[model samples]
Target: MDQHIAEAIGRPDLIHLDERLVCLRFETMKVVSALAAVRHLLDTGAVRRGDTLLDSSSGIYAYALALACHRYGMRCHIVGSTTVDRTLRTQLAVLGATLEQMEPCSDLKLDQKRRVERIHEILLHHPEYHWMRQYHDDIHYLGYRTVADRILRAVGTRSLTVVGGVGSGASTGALARHLRTAGPGADDVELVGVQPYGSVTFGAEHVTDPEIIIAGIGSSIPFGNVTHELYDTLHWVSFDAALVGSVDLLRRHAVFAGLSTGAAYLAARHERARSPERTVLFVAADTGHRYADTVHARHEEAADITGLAPQEVSDLSELALPWSRMHWNRAPAPAPAPRA
Candidate 1:
């Protein structure tokens, strides 16, 4: 029996959408990382039970860190992006986590920048507070080892393709890294990362999506933990395309997931079609409740996903609008671009 609610919430459900395609759905995915990270900090004497843990988040990570703090007897201070909704705000309050939300802004880059700046300011005020660098620390990867083992047990690593958003690199990167440890057939496990058009993490920063940049999948800034070499391929999915994929997923497979999941679902279908021998498992990071008004309610506006296809590109410079795919081939990270 699990001792804490965080453990239960972190546990993902493996649902087989088809013989070869699977959905690894989470209630709120980052709880795995947050709980493990906090536990590790306490174990290492880097922090005490009453120590305040600080971090910046868009939405999911904030709630995740709060839950972790609640379970571990720590205080959580979150510098939240403008995307943090009222429901999450109330939950954070009840969980005893303090949130410093930025002013409302649609531009993903600006919101992320503001949140980071706020985090730095807070650290200056409280020098003793521990900053849980979720974006840069490898400690976040520790929790996913068990998850990878579970996946390997259910669907052996033979010709396996793990698809998910390239968010902070903890989930997908850690899963692929741990899966590769299962001996012989481990080398066959391929990691395909899905990103938004404006995410700088994979060189898609040059391209701008007219609509919202799908949150949590991609980043406006560079993440140190994102081992670019772990990824075998890349898919830059726009908001409209992700919406269509999300709608199609619900209509067909009954998986009501977030924008990033929709993007991963779209990419997974494409990967599966190309490599029928591979068992494609994509991550559905969270539920669809938060996106109900933004995505599901606009189901009528969603285009027919069957008619869509990604524009394959050889270079980042060639990345286009609705969808684009590139063969990363376990390459090193691209040189950093000058920040605006």
Candidate 2:
């Protein structure tokens, strides 16, 4: 009876990827956010005892919410995305969260719409159930203060650039926003938002399916929190690019992280190569255990992943060049963090 599972959440050990790049392996980041959201509800009497907490998630948030509710003695129900798999189902069951999955759909936007619709239906039937509007709610942003503070502590005030998927606008946006004012390196932190090819967030056409193998990173739907201003530059990663990065991550660092992590890793490499002396940090959003079936490629040859994104493109497939990258602003003055 450890009774401290929540303690394990979000206290990730940072790993060095290169001289100037690091990975914050935040597999449990969602747990931190979920707990913060739920605890706020309970503390403010937003929802009373026995009230079911409901939300939609395709991946880590589902398990994260389940873990939060289980520890807090609150009943939880989840409307999971169509892409959620059997592995997550088993994990959710063990965590005691009730789940109603949407009908499987390939289109990302449609799948998101259907999940929201299902959530509305569930709300209509059970009005008492508290819906944690994770995407749009500012409460989702509170948990990352701890994350930003940790980075500031580990690496003193410096001009650090943070990169990661811009899904709900919660993780990368929230964390970067927090760091700007409070992080030790708050002076000139640049945020680079990452999205898969074809995501509507960065104004790319949805005619072709998004190359996002994992859900929750890129949404075809509008994300109210994902502000364009937050990210100075945007990188649109393709499935092939993410797969390439993921393979290299496993073979090189043995990180075993997800597609989102791979995308961040790729962006970090690109940034690091562009300016070797600057501190570039990225989020390893989750571990890759859930992506074992499709995203990994044991057969691919490994290389020390370097900058691939030469320029942003309208058609990710048409480029047929390398991974896409764009500079949204002039490179800020570099200030390296103190060494351990």
Candidate 3:
């Protein structure tokens, strides 16, 4: 009954993992945003069907945008990060998307910066290309409204906690915003965002994780769309902790999800333990196939999930270690990092 593949894959499967824990799993989560964003653009005359839509992506958004372009009869051009794995690159190519990938770069911030710079450079040559600013634009939030409605219908907003990685702020931020405005128990929904130690979004850039900075969940630069006030709490999860969570998720619940989902799951479990009265639902943004070699392969190295607990911190200055949790208290965005 779906009009397109994006519509089919964009629809998530809500799995009740436990009595109070739920998993909203998506094959490719950003398809929801890309589809709706493109539709809105077309409807509003912001872009036409044959136009080339461009954006910078680490991985997921490239595929999402490509699929959206394919569905809407548009061209997709992605300024890909160094992290754009071969799997995603091939998928994007097969879907008729042009990928301008960056050279090998170990530094996440530099890689992202280079991609953004390249996007601008391309725009200079091709002014006709419409740049889909996934990190900065609010148009990405419009798609999640339908997702919020589905969640509200399945699980009422009463004593609910929405947990997910704080990517571009479009996912968790939009979900919490739409759910809060839905009805009577609107205020009951709490948003708990998961972040990486290197992400500057919540002032975590000061702390560096020895392991890989889980891409997609965190950003080294400031994200314009991230409304810091939407989050009630924040969890900074390291790659090692998330590895355990991802392995445990597949081992226990059989949900094969990406690294970010693992991080969100780790935080969601903590929230559920702290508030048994509240139902915790975490977003599993994508499948585990992409992470099979990177994360899931080293299952032996993963610490026991049962023994892992985040160090609670009252302030960002107190943040430390493999895991840390802080009550953001709907605070304003932190000051942006000084550019070199």
Candidate 4:
């Protein structure tokens, strides 16, 4: 599976997963990120000799843009949040991309609208910069489609329950479009989207006071990539559940995934319980190493159903498995040593 995915991205180290859902084996984000940027430039006719491109990104997207800028010989300017990883920032700077950090929100809340506004302001200050606004770009979807294609091939079945969280919703929307237009067989696949409980934007009922921990999952406003018409169903997960899912993945599967991936996994399990016969595929967006200080720090907290501050939850060792018993760690014991 990794070999196939590597070939698609033209990088042998482009995939992180092995046959078993354990710790990541490679760094595929770099490949996918670059693919997204390059694909966007190609499809939009935005690429030009010495064209200066600007992007507002946190970390993963910034890495991609840096790679794209280097490959295309375009001057790149990245508007990033103060919370972005230092390693990523250093790498982007080392790649000759200009880095600008936006001040943290006064309310201590990281709002997408505010981030976009800040980036817009930066662009205004530098009129020469051409913003590759991800929210409005159709080509971003093409980059994410590669992931969906890999999922389809991995399962070796056309009928699947595709599940993932929606940050910008480009990936989910692209998967939906691919399934819908591919043919009669495509109809068998269902796309399930997961959103944070507090920031449910797509027909989800619950909405709590906003918090900034879950970085790549929530949005303040509907994006062009999120087409309700394409989604089959949407699931809302609490911060606590998402945290438990993250810890559970680490303890059981050895898959150190981010909170958004955990949220999506929880949603997938919920869907799987309703339809156990279907093959389920979910995206592991990134590793948890990046968020060790935040989500991973308070992972053992009790499952809080009430929409309160996450810190209020008490630490509990045994997590109540809300979904199923199919944990990552419960692999079957090897067959008993063969007798004579």
**Model 4 Cα RMSD, Å?**
12.0
lDDT of 3 by residue, 191-219 (tens): 99999998999998888899889999889
Q: Candidate 3: what lDDT?
A: 0.94
Lowest summed lDDT window (length 10), candidate 3: 331-340
lDDT of each: 0.93, 0.76, 0.94, 0.59
Residue 87, model 2: lDDT of 84
Cα-based RMSD of the predictions, in order?
A: 1.1, 6.9, 1.2, 12.0
Q: Decide which is better by TM-score, 1 or 4.
A: 1
lDDT of each residue in 120-145, candidate 2, tens digit only: 99889989889898887878887888
lDDT measured at residue 239 in model 4 versus the true structure, 0 to 100 = 62
CA lDDT of 205 in candidate 1?
84
lDDT of 3 at 50: 97
Off by over 4 Å in 3: 337-340
Clashing pairs in 1: none
Flag the better candidate by lDDT, 1 or 4: 1
Question: After superposition, which runs of candidate 1 have C-alpha atoms over 4 Å from their true positions?
Answer: 338-340
Span of 10 residues, lowest total lDDT, candidate 2 = 330-339
Cα lDDT of model 1 by residue, 1-340, tens digit: 9999899999999999997999999999999999889999999999998999999998999999999999989999999888889999999999999998899887778888888888888889999999999999999999998899899889989999999999999999999999998998698899999999888898888888998888899998889899999999999999999999999999999989888999999999999999998899999999999999999999998999989999999998899989999999999998776668
Q: Which candidate tops lDDT?
A: 3
